[model samples]
Target: MTTPLPQKSFHDVRQALLARQEIALVDVREEDPFAQAHPLFAANFSAGRIEIEAWNRIPRRDTAIVVLDNGEGLAEPAARTLQNLGYTDVALLAGGLQGWIDAGGEIFKDVNVPSKAFGELVESQRHTPSLSAEEVKALIDQKADVVVLDARRFDEYQTMSIPTGISVPGAELVLRAQALAPNPQTRIIVNCAGRTRSIIGTQSLVNAGIPNPVSALRNGTIGWKLAGQVLDHGAERQGRALTEKTSADAARQARAVADRAGVQRAQPADLAAFQAEAGRTTYRFDVRTAEEFSAGHLPGFLNTPGGQLVQETDVSAPVRGARIVLADTDGDGGVRANMTASWLAQMGWDVWVLDGSPAADWSETGQPAAAVPPPEGHTEWISPAQLSTWLQGDTAAETVVLDMTTSVNYVKRHIPGAWYISRTDLADALAKVPKAQRYVLTCGSSLLARYAVADVARLTGAEVFVLKGGTAAWITEKLPLEHGETHLASPRTDRYRRPYEGTDSPREAMQGYLDWEFGLVDQLGRDGTHGFRVI
Candidate 1:
């Protein structure tokens, strides 16, 4: 039997925060439930993802970590997982989320509370200029000399965006703004799905000393919707990659801003030394466009767009005291890295920008290949055609099919009698499934399903098979599909339902989201645990 784990009262955690010490208040729930309500400093280290993300997120083995969930029975298991992974200090919140509330701790809605709160702090301190939805709409209606820049990922901009807004993303804002609005007289407005990126993007240009007048589209796309303004759907106006001269200029400017923000520069040797440190967690990321990163990137470096990194710091790096290294190879200069490092520095991170010279030496291109292979003597793939034949056979009732796609996607479409199960809970969920001679697994793509073949086999000792090419391939072959949630072996808590993601979210939820953000400062004041320092 597992030993009883240590526990921390909310007050103890609060005191630790007040002391300005490093503490990772982790919520072990999935992104969806964690986003609904959590402490301001809580980092979501989802239960199913602990093994993959724990090392990078919590670098120091001895750093204090407190895990919690709303009585979902996930915190204990998460704590045990950390202990097994060589984490020296791990504990659970005494009463989970409710304990914090009973202790008068503030609860925040949404993800990336640290970054979002810091953005609010930046706005309050710098008074970042902004225009309401009505004002911006009028400017477009009158054909004013203005350019609206969507400071969000291209896919988000494609989903729904302000009319005439160009997809500039986050870190790309400073690099491409001058070219997009060459005339100094032309006013520039930056926007995102919500307030953080819009505020940060606008402030970034102002901090870099751009020539044009910059303002955030107040409250972002959420504000636009609340104002009853129509948004453009499937818009594809994206900023082009920076030119040679433009990249050099951007590098110089970004380096200067980083210096002002007290961000350090890391050489290849310095990075090696950082990794060699005995008890520190270090994350190395290439803060460039996905395409640029895919074309070529440093070994051991993950790609995270600069703007999104700042917007989702908690999600990207959960350990508050861990070191972070940012890199970019744009025209022989790490411009995006420097710019991204500046914001992270201001937000109280020990961040560094890497030199761009070494990036050219790596000849390898495309995503890094996975290291794990299928277990020996367990290689079997069932084509959609074969699966269809089985479904119509005499033993059809004995062949069990499990769909591992997202809860939302599973609800939208699945095989007629396929049972929806969480990949993390597959072993336990098998007890609920009727005994079958064989089990078949499938997802949106077969990649994840293939990875699960060994696990399913180990848990049940049955004939397990992977659906070739997944559900997408089945549709290509004109296979019939059933819609809606017909069968579910588990609760639909694996994915978070974002108000900004779907088209049919209520206006009240959108306004409530804005209202929650507006109150973050006050909540931070009450918590007194957020160790944020705006530069």
Candidate 2:
């Protein structure tokens, strides 16, 4: 028999981790068990995903790796596979997690790995308190004294959010919280889907020792959905309304706090002059509601909204020490924008806000004319004669077809051999597309196809062409259309089930979620009247 592999002691692994050694901890349990609980920072490289997403997800081949499973079922095989893939340092976690646990090591729980641990910290500190869906509805019914602050990314909030919640992302909480909740008596609640930032945000206020009692909207919009609550999706300006406790009052308090914090705002001309200055990197943001933003706003402006801009500034603008300019449509936007600017100033960024309305609305005052309506949809029908000619000619090896329509539509039907990539995943997908390829973009509607062309041109600087009227026009004109799965693979359909939250069966995930909510309700009861309840 071959000699047994060297086994590392628990202390050795822990020491290696503390010293920041090049180590990849792999939990080899089935996806469900692994997802429920594992060592913090452990990457999931299941047998299936390893073959497909491994190269993309984990690019380093020289990093040391340690694999573990419930017993030893998958550890050896996974280690061998990584070794075969040119991983220089790969080994099995001797005794696996059981040995670590037996040695009294810690294990973390929750969905989405690292985010859950962060959320747990927020929850433990009471950093975020949230109302259940029922509680929000009841509050609405009772006309209670509370303000709802949505802490999700801007796009997600615009797509769907609690009816009354005003968008104020986590990073901006310290700056904008006072504006959303002025008095110590007026309650403030933060929300995000399934905790994380909502909890972290609520806690941030508490940690800063704000006078008001702040809580998280527990479980966020997802919990709201599971609670059988109705979400307001039709475009409406619910954020414009002010309760008896308003953001205006909060703004006054925030301005006072800003004075104490030594924060400043910039006038429109000052901002314009700054933009004109050379060798300076600046990101201008319009922090208005999506509807107001899409209707008409500044040129070359991204509609981040107040809440999400605060939460995802790092992803939105990764460069440090860059100047930031914010624009708001009304009191809500203005207060939130100023609040975010204040924080960035404290964080060593040169931040400013426009003194007046966004540029798109300045047309009435003889500013550049109002934004022109985007062009109507087009249908570029390639004649049958033209198609024959192109087919006869040599096909470019560096050609790619991007289908930017909805996933559901792509599944139902699409052009033959076209790569299906949703708009949401465009930024990431573009990075993987070979620069050598001449991309041809298409979508269900010609409008989206044109938008894809523009995006490709802006992002890649590569030659791109649209399919004229998109796949719809192609089919309508009796042109050939391809069907069935093409280059795309199906997403993982295996659902995770939690026994602690409910049963081990897949059907019990929802029930388990409900059970967790009930537990939260009980905890809230003992914790006193933070003004939240579960339905």
Candidate 3:
């Protein structure tokens, strides 16, 4: 018989947050529903993705973790999974997500609530300067001495950007703002897909004491669209490299800001000491541009560009009270790491920046390899060519194919007649699909699908084979593709469409997103556990 797991009440979790004690409040639901409503710091750990993401997210096996689920029935199984995977202190919430609601815990909408709310807090406290989208448009129309910087990812900038704006992500603002607008007479405006990045990026410039007058493009591209202003698509503009003196100066200013925010500086010895503490969870990250990190980075340090690190802190460091160390090879002080540390410190993290300059031998290169567990059980595999032939012929009726790729990818391109399902939800999802004499599973690379082979084989009581190389292999063979929601065996709970994203967000939604962000400062106050402070 299984032993009953320990349970933590809503008061227990709140106390831990308020006291700055270590506790990970994990929501074991998929992203879509989790985004719709959850407690402020509850990190989303989807039931299907536990194996692939757990090790990196919660590095310390003994760290306290509280798993919660609504009516989804995932919490207990997830807690068991964590225990099986060597997590020693995993438990269930006292009454689950519903319990939290009943106990008066705040339910927040959207992903990255902690970071987004902190951005709002920063703006409210500092009263960061801003220019309306209309005003920025007029400046551009008049060919005024103004430079606009987009503080989002480059692909996001390319999709749609303010006219004459160049990509300069949040952390890069301090490092490159002066280079883009050297003249003090020039006005600098920072914009993002929405408000968070712009507010943070604009404040970063102000914190660094950049000579040019800096302000955020009020409400960003959404505001531009709302104001009936046009945007430039496929913009490839970027800021130039900074000189050694300029880089050093930026680092100094960033370090000062981080100091004001109470960020700690760690030498190599200090990092070693922190990692040696068995009771603590330490996350080491290389906070540089992906391209720069790929060229070379320190061993054992995962690469998450600084701007993205701030935006997705919950994803990167799920253990709420863990210690985070940021690294960058930006000369001695590392402007990127320092600036990133400042924001993280304000967001209530015990963040550190490496003090010493990196040595010549930065050994590791390329993206960090994923740690995928071996498949559930041994199974035969069918090649893409063979599967394609079967699909075109009579055997198609006897064979059923399952696609475990993300819904977004499944919608873009997938095998003809392939049904998409979340592997973790297979039991319920499989009942929807017609059973056949044989079953086949495939994902982007067959990496995740192979794990589902045993599950499907047992469920159907039929011959099961994994598609070799998965869907990518089929695409490589130039096989015919089908798009959209062709055969969905499961609800598309893997993705949550953001209110501020895409070409045609309803005007109401865009305004509502802004309105939600505007009220976050008050929400944070009412929640009272964030511990955020703007310097």
Candidate 4:
């Protein structure tokens, strides 16, 4: 029999949150189930992803971590994994997610609750101005002096957008708004796929004191669609470039906003000090476009576009009480990092903007690869061509392919006849697969699959092989790929489908999502653990 892991009561975790002590309230289930219900601050770190994600996200092995699941049996394996990963302080929530409910903790739904809730709270306190979707549409129809700025990512803008909107993702809004709308009389409209980014983006310009009038398109694209407006598909309007003068002026305004929001400015020495702190978890992020970061950036800083970083804080920095240090290559000053830090500070983070020019040796370029722990034992790997030949062989009937990629990716495409399996739950998933003489493991890069090879070999006592390049390499080899969920060994709990994502969400669900956002402020108040304060 297994000894139960040490546990923390709901009060214990809540106290850590309220006291602003370093604690990670982690839910080990996949996002789909986690989003259905969890404490307001619970960060989802699915059991299977701990090895790849925990080090970068939590950063400090000694930080208190309380893992929970709604009786899904994922927490125990995850806690053990954390311990194996050299995490010194790992524990379980006393009664799982149920304990929080039993203790009268306020449960919240959907992902990025902290950031989304903060957006709602900001609007509630600041009363950030907004115009109805219909009102904005009339302005566009009249060819009025207005430029709609989509606060979503560029790809999202391309998927669908307002007829004449420009892609100026959240963090870029302040830095580029002036150049995009030079005339002081132009009405600036900000929008996103949903309310949070729209509210935050518009409020950013307002707080930065942009001269032109600005307002969020109320409820964003969902509202636009509900109002019977036709969204343009495949729109590709980018935010206009800024001249030196405009960039410098924007930097000055951004600094002022950061100052007003109490964001601390940090130099390299200060950042070095932050890195040397043994007991604290500090995330160093370069808040710039990934391409810019790839060209060159300060060492030890991860690339997280400022907009997405703010939108998905729970994922980017799951250690709720950890310190965050943001760096940017904005000219004259760290405009992007400053603007991002201002919002983070208001969201109750101890954040700093690393300012000034990066030295020549800030020459470290490219994104850091996930440092996946290697497999305990090795398995033979076959090239895509070899696998293709084997699949066409007479004994192919006895060979089973296990695809360990995300369910969504698996649904979209996979190796022909591959059985989808949640690697963390492989033992049980194996029962659903046919008895076979050979088993193969493959994922996106085969990096994740490589780790699973040893586990599969141990479980099935069969000849297990890993695809050398994963599914990506197979596709690159011009092999035929299969689509759809042909065989699922485990449930598709890897991701949560947001009502605001994609263009095909049901109208009822869209309205329901909007209604959910409306109540977030009250929920935040009741929870009383968030340290958010809008300036």
Using TM-score as the measure, which candidate wins?
A: 4
Query: By the lDDT metric, which is better: model 1 or model 2?
Result: 1
Q: Candidate 3 at 88: error in angstroms?
A: 1.2
TM-score of each candidate structure, all chains considered together: 0.90, 0.47, 0.97, 0.98
Better of 3 and 4 by TM-score: 4
Each prediction's whole-model lDDT (CA): 0.83, 0.56, 0.89, 0.89
Per-residue lDDT of model 2, residues 1-535, tens digit only: 8444556656666666555343456665545567665665466655422333333233355555677776736677667655656666677777887876787666654434333333453355443456677877787678787887776655556666677777665545655566556667877878765565676567556655568877777766666767777665532332333543445554554455444444556676776777677545567777655666666666655666654554444334433335678776554535556655554454345667666655555332212222222422432334333433443457544556677665557767876667776443356667765564467777775445554555566688767666666777766777556675564532222234333221122324545653554354334333221222110
* Per-residue lDDT over 36-67 for candidate 4, one digit per residue giving the tens place of the 0 to 100 score: 99998899998877887888788888999999
Query: Which one wins on lDDT?
Result: 4
Clashing pairs in 1: 32-496, 59-281
Tens-digit per-residue lDDT, 1-535, candidate 1: 8689999999888887676566788998877788889988899876765655676567678888999999988899889878887777899999999999998888988888888888998898899999999999999999999999998899889999999999998899878888888788999999988899999999988888877999999999988988999999999899875566666667678888999999998888998899888766788888888888888878878788999999888877877767899987746366678889999999888899887455465555787654332333555888999999999899898799888887888889888788888766777777777778899888887655665677788888889998988988888999999888888886787777667665667998888888888888888777777667666
Q: How accurate is candidate 2 locally (lDDT)?
A: 0.56
Task: Point out where model 1 deviates above 4 Å.
Answer: 11-23, 51-64, 85-88, 241-246, 330-332, 369-386, 423-435, 445-483
The TM-score ranking, best first, is 4, 3, 1, 2
Q: Choose 2 or 4, whichever is better by lDDT.
A: 4
Which stretches in model 4 have alpha-carbon errors above 4 Å? 1-3, 330-332
RMSD of 1: 3.2
* Residue pairs in collision within model 2: 127-202, 127-203, 129-215, 129-216, 130-216, 130-217, 130-218, 169-307, 380-468, 380-469
